[model samples]
Target: MNAAVHIPEYFEDCDLVEGEDLVREPAFWLAHVLLTMGDPGEVERYGVDASAYEAMVDRLADPGQPWPVLRVCFTGGHTAYVVYANFEDENNVDFFVRHPAWGRLGHLGQCGADEAGPGLSWAELISLAASAQDGEEGLSDPSQRLLLLLPMLGDADMPGGARDTVARALAGCGIRPDAAGELAASLLGEQDSTGGPRWTVTGDSPIAVCSSPYSPRRVPLGLGISPEQAQALANALHGSVPPTASGGFTG
Candidate 1:
């Protein structure tokens, strides 16, 4: 009946178990966190939009692939994660901030309160964030630092600026309006042994990097192609990488 009565507590310091089961079903995760953690309104958009994201894996996930697992912990602690999402371009790189259990820090709560918040109050989080700038770590540790985002306007309870921050963070993990853009951007194409396509598209983040920023980065656009396919894609893209780019990256 009522969801609040059975709220769960935070996970252990480094407990990484069947988090996949929890993330696979977003509604349960949201309710569990909201009830157990209380709706701090830091990570989520509050209703449908937030629900759409949290439940996305369960709603439309590839069962063939292993469910993306996550871990949770208190301030300055570490959890486990299944993916290290990121995206690289010519110069920069961006990552998805997964707390092993905290899910996406951007989606958990306001900075520092949720996974990235280190369980601190808003005031503490702000101060921590301010302090990070003076040190070697600039918001690298979620416990010690926090993302200062507050909902400022519109249907989105999250501020436009804050929303952008979350948006970029989500992008770091390949969560965006165009989920397939990664495959659509390349002028070249090939397929993996499992018939997976080897193409290129501008992704928000590269695979297997879970940090933050969620900005656009140089995505490693490499594909393994047979001689025939290589020639074709190369021709399409105005020739291969001049032998060096044309060489086999792995073997």
Candidate 2:
């Protein structure tokens, strides 16, 4: 179940960015895809060889390419896969999620347009994946679910205005507003070992948000969740407010 084996050879040398927090901004996901599409300034900043980078982009953009252009690996051999053959020519992309234990592949959703019209953007698809995986174990604790949802705030003022937002959201789940506010502030302000906001839910082998090896972006990864729960949570969080467009990617 070594998920790394699933990574295509073309991306072998490319850096893998991981994290636990759900990144909710379309711009954040779009920026990464756009970077791979060719950002001369970003290439120069990263000191990547111009010609070599262009060659990788060419291979990724090949119309006949069959593998995913990007793979977001989660804990326990779960992965969220993305395919976009030519970002320059089309804004569309397809998304899939795989669970090794279940031996099942789930079509989460798609980004961009088709005969069915516009689809979810990359940000939306990622958010859906995160939410689905976060609730996979079926942790019913209001506080735990709050932790799972907090990262979706994405750089918002936590324990300040955002505390009220979390409290309000939790109130609907039966938590008192005042206690919910306190819990939200406590969790949002705490940092993980990497100095990023914490996202560890409480339970045996509890799910924790972890930082990416090569980038600042964080995503939640864990085990024991059913695909049905993943889909249900994804559908619920899909309507939540989108993240504000302020963060920037460094890798």
Candidate 3:
């Protein structure tokens, strides 16, 4: 953690505490595992475009006022397991509300104490969230706090398929496949990689898969996604939309 990042007066007022010890927290650990294998550049590599990626992150940060609990999440690593805030407060919420595609879904909008609303409508909320900024203080790294909130994707605490898929996706972004595999295991709390957990990605059209030398299971390629990519998919799965899309998600 950078000392410069810790000097924000708002955090102090919010009773926020910052430290590396956050890695020990369950939330941070899980998030770290996922991010360890995540590649922040997936959108660019996959041809999703930089602006689209940024817009996706913005949407995740603040879903809207009615459904303020959700937040955006993405991989962050200078090295070691790292996470990024995606969304930490009201400004993000307000921006998402006013954005065209995302604003219509009232209950799913991202919300926090920082927003002002006549109870902002869907359109208003998307617009606000899209326009919100970090101000001169710069952005806050609330990765530690956001991880605790990542919803369990399956019946188990961590979804083995989701973790592996995310790692594979990161690998496609140029990370080493072995490292991505290890990261997947770490994020799912599956410390040992020996057990062959079967998984597959069904592409829009069928695609060939290669079996891992280490495991009998075949790995999916086109299905690969980074932490941010995973988060974007998750938001879509949860029924939210990006502001630019008339329907929220791109078909």
Candidate 4:
């Protein structure tokens, strides 16, 4: 297949090179995101408030350590991504972490990174990763999401008979009713016309979804998502919070 993405110039000659192939490296990645801090408007984009961002980074990492880490991941496409909250109004949104160094930069639009904003040095970050080589690699692999989701297919834990309805719909679509969970699981890899790992089905669009909520500016749920909405998604995905609770047409 075509390269997952055009390997950016940054990784043009890394020892990890594989003749322009997309090989699974770190399953899950956590870095301080030195570019965001002190960059006015960046910190708030990841949490409820600037202090919340500070508190989290401080709570989780040491001084001069990777703080307010953004989880980086790559699945189907060559891009690695991160989903966080919006700074403007506190909405949970996802965006690209492109560097051309990480094989491909996550975002390729107006977002700028001419130089490191204000934080650790590249050497320091590299050293940190080397030290944590033992850290576990995460799994958001596109092909396996279906299996991860199988247990929820007919579970009573799903709200408002939604699971049952979804199963029926899958069967109607000529998909095996038993593969209902696979369908939903498979969707974790997409949304709203844009490719991403985050997904949401609005009350307005029961049969569809939107992905990649942040671009330093939010796209509409019809297009992407906002922090408040992302938080609602978190609640639902974790608590079986019904779509109706988020004011949906589906209910």
Candidate 5:
């Protein structure tokens, strides 16, 4: 089947169901995002070797204590993620505390990357994956502003395949394959194209436009965790946050 057929038209405008408080304990919360939204290439780019990460799937399944849940809040300028767990050290803090979603809460102090550059939310990430634009950078302009990426890479079961599926969908929309890196760029504001952006990843007047340099490195997720498990984690985190004073956000 043509995977492009499933791609959404307005990648940035795609609907996202806001989750309640999934993040309570920052460490555990960070782990959850690392499990789900972390960018492996970013990790590698920062000199963090993938080989050094100890696969935590086994720990997540410990029955005695399942992995902590994380819920991230979304906004036009930033994202906020809450975690529920007993955090211990810098490793946990480094992974989640520095995450883009949680960083919106001033959790990272001046260490936040999005403060100086374009960052993305999971919703935006998914939207880019399903759009006709380049998923990563390097296809055309490396400094394009249409795209934003979060540093967290993979936690979902089908990492590489999943990335490919989204890429194919975007390509179906007419985006070039070389622009794959754009998929990780930040999605900010709605674009009112005069005649709809060209699906072509290259050349001016293309269907989609990427705003930054997208790294080509495809990161890895831990083994054994299923998409269902990830969804469950998202749901659990939702139940933890309290509602707003206006009677909204029934976590």
Candidate 6:
């Protein structure tokens, strides 16, 4: 008998169920996304280096390499990913970016654990990748406000008071008060058990912040505020009393 005819018989001893669960599996979604991607040549028009892009594609396609452990999709149809390449080493994770436009892929670099601090979280990686493409102003777009707050929202060490402060600040940026709070709460719910490390302000020239030790990325703060104001905001988010003279965080 043909192998096709024995397909059912071959799996008769295996347990099977019919429903949406199989379709909803991570493996299924990964395969679907990979299959739908256009030819990598399309990415060349954007000026991406052919060799590097091809190497990234090869690594992703290699079954011997680790599969992407996490994927975050932005409102603008951009996607960020983290692939854990080594289980024994905490720093052996790679960040990758992709957009629906050309399905172009870019490597954001690898992150690993270090004695200095914590590594970047998937949310921060998404923000960095998005900002690189759309610039800081894109982060402040009213439609993307929630995404802008994700790095802070996903910080497990952020205090409730700080969260409230951030929500109020976001409201000042044009989001409805009630909507802002609800959105923050909803995002928190989604990550209640998976919050990453705390965010710490490490510089002032441009207001840089780090989420963890040995992180390869440092996110610049201040959606549009002065350097001093950004410093105050970072302090407030860390649960410190902002100088009353600083006027508090507006954004």
Which prediction has the highest lDDT against the true structure?
Answer: 2
Write the residue-wise lDDT of candidate 3 on 195-239 in tens digits.
322233345313222222322113322134443443333333223
**Residue range 1-251, candidate 2, lDDT tens digits:** 11223434223443222212212222222233333222334333333345655665554445454433344443344555555534435644444455555444444334344311112222332344343333233223333333322332232112224445444444444344445555445434542334433333234322232232321222323133564645443444343435333321111
Q: Which has the higher lDDT value, candidate number 1 or candidate number 5? A: 5
Worst 10 residues of 3 by lDDT: 74-83
What are the RMSD figures for all models against the true structure? 20.9, 16.4, 18.4, 18.3, 20.8, 18.5
Backbone clashes in model 6, listed as residue pairs: 91-112, 117-212, 117-213, 118-212, 118-213
Per-residue alpha-carbon lDDT of model 1 for 1-251, expressed as tens digits?
11111112222322212333333333433333233223424334322256464555232233333222333222323221222111121111011222233332322222111233112212222222232222221223331122111110011111123323323322332333242233111201221224321223334322211122221212221222233433332232221222122111111
lDDT score for candidate 6 against the true structure: 0.36
lDDT of 4 at 36: 27
| Model 1 stretches with alpha carbons more than 4 Å out | 1-69, 72-160, 177-251
Off by over 4 Å in 5: 1-147, 166-175, 178-251
Q: Candidate 6 lDDT, tens digit per residue, 14-113?
A: 2222112212222322222222211222433333344644555444345454343444444344444444343332324444444433323433344334
Provide the clashing-pair count of each candidate structure. 28, 7, 31, 13, 47, 5
Give residue 25's lDDT in candidate 3 (0 to 100).
Answer: 29
Once fitted onto the true fold, the runs of candidate 6 whose alpha carbons sit more than 4 angstroms away are 1-70, 86-91, 96-156, 159-208, 211-213, 219-251
Off-target runs (Cα >4 Å) in candidate 3 are 1-9, 12-160, 191-237, 240-251
Tens-digit lDDT string for candidate 5 (130-223): 2322222111111111111233322122222334433333333333455433542221112234431222223322112223233111111111
How do the predictions measure up, each by TM-score? 0.21, 0.31, 0.23, 0.21, 0.20, 0.27
Candidate 4 runs further than 4 Å off: 1-57, 60-63, 67-77, 82-104, 108-251
lDDT of the candidates, in the order given:
0.25, 0.37, 0.30, 0.27, 0.26, 0.36
TM-score of candidate 5 against the unseen true structure: 0.20
